[model samples]
Target: MFDGVARWWDGFELWLAQQWFPVQFVLVAAVLLPLCVGMAWVIHRGVEAVADRLGRLCRADAAGNGHGVVDEGHGGRPDAVS
Candidate 1:
């Protein structure tokens, strides 16, 4: 069965190699376009999910840290009260 599949693949490769340049480009694009789009969509979704988790973590940290937030001009450190 493996031999058969390999032979068929070799034959197909030869046939594709003999095809015209435009035909080969079209055939490859037909397969690659959707594949690349799907991979990009998956990556985009993963990035969005990570961004959401990071945002949640940042909000939680801010809430847990209580007062003094960070950008209040104190430079994020405790004020000097000699």
Candidate 2:
């Protein structure tokens, strides 16, 4: 199966190499445009999910006491978030 596909890909590559520049350009654009768009969409969704998680954590921290606020600890120094 792998060898079959590899041979087919080699034949296709040879055919594409012999094609006109416009045809090559069109094929590249046709393949790359959707691939780039899909990658961008996935990245955007991932970033959105991360932002949502961070927002929830921030809200939770804000709702709790002594979070993001400097309170005196055992040595009268500002305490870290707990």
Candidate 3:
């Protein structure tokens, strides 16, 4: 059973790697380019999420009236002595 599964996977890999030139660019565009874009989009979203979370953490330590810090200056820092 394991050998059969291995054989099947090997055949699938060969099929996927086969270079049929007639529609090579189409296949690359359809399969590879979107894959890269999707991966990049996922990475961008993850970084944005991390940045938002870090911003929240930094804001949590700001000095204010406990309702969270309000941006009042060029650097978006909390108001002085608030």
Candidate 4:
């Protein structure tokens, strides 16, 4: 199976190498540009998801009393407002 796949790939590579310059450029760009954009979008979304999760964790840790206020004193406890 692997040998068959390799042989097909070699033939494809040779065919690409024999194409005219403009045709080759268009073919490479048509195959690669969308792939690059898709990968970048996926990476961006993954980073955004991780950032959102970390933000939520930090907010939860800061808001110890569930009121969303971080205490600047009293050893990191929730602040009490009168």
lDDT of model 4 at residue 50? 86
TM-score of each: 0.76, 0.77, 0.54, 0.77
Ranking of candidates on lDDT, top first: 4, 1, 2, 3
lDDT of 4: 0.81
Clashing pairs in 4: none
* CA lDDT for candidate 3: 0.73
TM-score of 1: 0.76
- Model 1 Cα lDDT, one tens digit per residue, 1-80: 99999999999999999999999999999999999999999999999788767765775688678952544344333332
Number of clashing pairs per prediction, in order? 0, 0, 0, 0
Better of 1 and 4 by TM-score: 4
Worst 10 residues of 1 by lDDT: 73-82
lDDT of 2 by residue, 1-82 (tens): 9999999999999999999999999999999999999999999999978876776566567658655643345332222354
TM-score of 3: 0.54
- Name the best candidate (by lDDT): 4
lDDT tens per residue, model 4, 24-74: 999999999999999999999999788767766776776766766754565
lDDT scores in order: 0.79, 0.78, 0.73, 0.81
Model 4 segments more than 4 A misplaced: 65-82
For candidate 4, the TM-score is 0.77
